[model samples]
Target chain A: MKTKKIATYGLLVSLAFILSYLESLFPIPIPIPGIKIGVANLVVMIALYGFGSTQAFVLSIIRIILVGFTFGNLSTMMYSLAGGLLSCLLMILFKKLKFFSMVGVSIIGGISHNIGQILMAILILESASIINYLPALLITGTITGTLIGIIGGLIEKRLKKFLVNY
Target chain B: MIKKNDFILIGIILAIVLLIWSLSFFKINWPMNFFMKTEGSKVRITVDGQEYKILDLDKDTTFSIEQENGKFNTFEIRDGYVDMIDASCPDKICVHQKEIHYDHETIVCLPNKVVLEIIDGQVNEVDSVAN
Candidate 1:
């Protein structure tokens, strides 16, 4: 059981890293700084549902670090850490509530991710004016988060069946 | 499994987003028109919450400001419109943003802590008139 759990975590980490790398390849035309499809969150979402919060937290941290080292700088790492940590916390909260499914949890995670990064931007810049972008960010977060949630729900269902057979 | 309630929740969230989105479009024009009655507006630049400089929109000029932290942003004011043509910030969000001519519009460079706001020069004139 121990070996299986470790193996699952290792695989999840690699999968998340690969998804982040793939996400960077797609260039979004919008110049808005903290906007992206966030394909990597899908992996995190799946991990949270499949294994649990502890494993999901570990996977998220490792994925952010590896992605930062490979494709980002110090500021990028700071933003990712802030966003990823908050998103993970919210996801766990919603998951425990049991009021919402994978889709709802993922949506909350996505929106929290943007809020965390925006807060970091405010602190780093020392400017309250950055709050001007809140409306647009929230809209984008909900749209992208819903899409990610749908994908995560489908994968989680498949993974459950596969794990049972294995 | 996504329950029926989840869809309702998402719908409510979307409605809230739609309201906020629409509100941004209706930004108060009262103050904007009040300021526009004057011949020209002034562009106020602030760095780290300190008033840096104010430029008249009547002049066509390009100027640059170098912050104490070594970052800089360049602005080009032409025909009463100001544009952030260049910035030393990592993301360059200000440079990519559209030019502004209306009163109270702002071009903000968060990484460099620079804020270029279009203020009504007439407000000061009005204050002086009151005095």
Candidate 2:
């Protein structure tokens, strides 16, 4: 691990942590539980494109753990872990396929993140009726994912100039 | 930078959403109601997957449940709708959720492990025949 790479990881992780904190402070007006714009995901997507899958995975895990402990409880941490891991894996897989652009990959990530949390909720609550929120969640996820992907695409272009050779 | 596949993906997702929305819509609006009459419905409360209480929707009343962990949730039944009025949970998502009146509608408080669902009050002969 190069020192530059390590420093970038630290910076990105802190950025993600701050975004998580800001997000928690102002919950989305929607009353639905486990719905978030996932701003921290922008950092993860950047890491995935600018860095690599391993770095993105590491950054996502660290961010979730840090944010979970700082702003949430054990159960919240579990939910974040489930959503984070699933979304990260899917984003990586989609990126590898090369069929979709950053926007496409991020949209998949957003949708999977919600699905992961809902699945966790179903397991913990032991109730299948909670699945009723899936359509709304999916729609929100898609919209938010598209927005984040657009922003990520813009950032990636500028970041490429500075982050040449990883 | 969007790609052709991205549009296709969005289309597929919208299609799935439409399918699910229509399915749930039809289940609640058309065929089920045509066969089984909703003479009345009751609010079924559960804690940790166990039945807690069943409240009549016709009679307006407020009810509260105290969990073993000292957490609590309070709900009100009014005019055939069940609404979660208060909760000790930090998120309070259940309290903010829309009031449920239709059968199978639910308001769940995960932190408190409380679930409020609407179920048919009395099973009629039509329901039995369909079953």
Candidate 3:
């Protein structure tokens, strides 16, 4: 059982890495910076629902660090760390509450992710005016988070049986 | 399947975003008619939170900025307008942005951490007061 868990997590990490790579391939160009679909969150969400918070957190960190080294700079790593950690935290909290389904949780995650990134932006730029981008970032977050939630829900439904045995 | 509450949440988020976006237009000291009358004769450039250079819009000239890592951005000040004509950043979003000459308007290149903001007059007293 222990070995199975390790193997499964490793596979999930690779899946997330691949998803991140795929997202960079065809970026949706909006006029704003730090905006993307963040498809890797789908894998993280799946890990959360399947194996709980510990597994989800592990996968999130590993994916961010590995991807940051492979395709990003120091600033990118910092932004990703801030956004990913906050997003994951919110996802776990919402999931525990059980008031909302996967979709709603994902939306919350997305919103918090943007908030986290903007916080980092404010700190790095040392300008409060950077907060002006909040509304736009939140809107983009909502749209992308909703999409990720829907996709995660479908994936979870299909893998439910296998996940239970694992 | 999405629930009724989910739709409500979406509506709330959309409404909030729209509210903030619309509110920005009415900010005090920001002339509603930006194009009709423009102020601010100086542009402040900063990189990675450090002041790089300041330029007077009254003088028309072109200059290039090369960063420590060999990345660069080129700017042109013509007819009292500042425009980023070229940049080494891959996205080129900064290069494609339109020129600016209004107070508080900013052009930001995220990858390069470069910011160009316009301020009114010789001194930024209003900005200090607001802050």
DockQ for the candidates, in order:
0.33, 0.38, 0.28
Q: Assess candidate 3 and give its TM-score to the true structure.
A: 0.76
* Residue-by-residue lDDT tens digits, candidate 2, A5-99: 77888899999999999999989866455699999999999999998999999999999999988999998998899999999999999999998
Instruction: Compose the digit string of candidate 3's lDDT tens values, residues A1-166.
Output: 9999889988999999999999878877663445778899999999999889989998999999999999888987888898999999989998898767788888888888888887888788865455656777888899998999999999999999999999
Model 2 Cα RMSD, Å?
A: 5.2
RMSD of each: 5.7, 5.2, 5.6
Ranking by DockQ: 2, 1, 3
- Which candidate should be chosen as best, given DockQ against the real structure? 2
Docking class of 2: acceptable
Deviation in angstroms for A77 in model 3?
Answer: 0.6
lDDT string, candidate 1, A23-89, tens digits: 8898575545567788999989988888788988999999999999999999889999999999999
TM-score of the second chain, each candidate in turn, equals 0.65, 0.64, 0.66
Compute the interface RMSD for candidate 1. Answer: 4.6
Q: What are the Cα lDDT values of the candidates?
A: 0.80, 0.85, 0.82
Model 3, residue pairs in steric clash: none
Off by over 4 Å in 1: A162-166, B29-106, B109-114, B117-131
What is the Cα-based lDDT of residue A79 in candidate 2? 88
Candidate 3 per-residue C-alpha lDDT over B87-114 given as tens digits, one digit per residue, 9 for 90 to 100: 8788676776557777666776766778
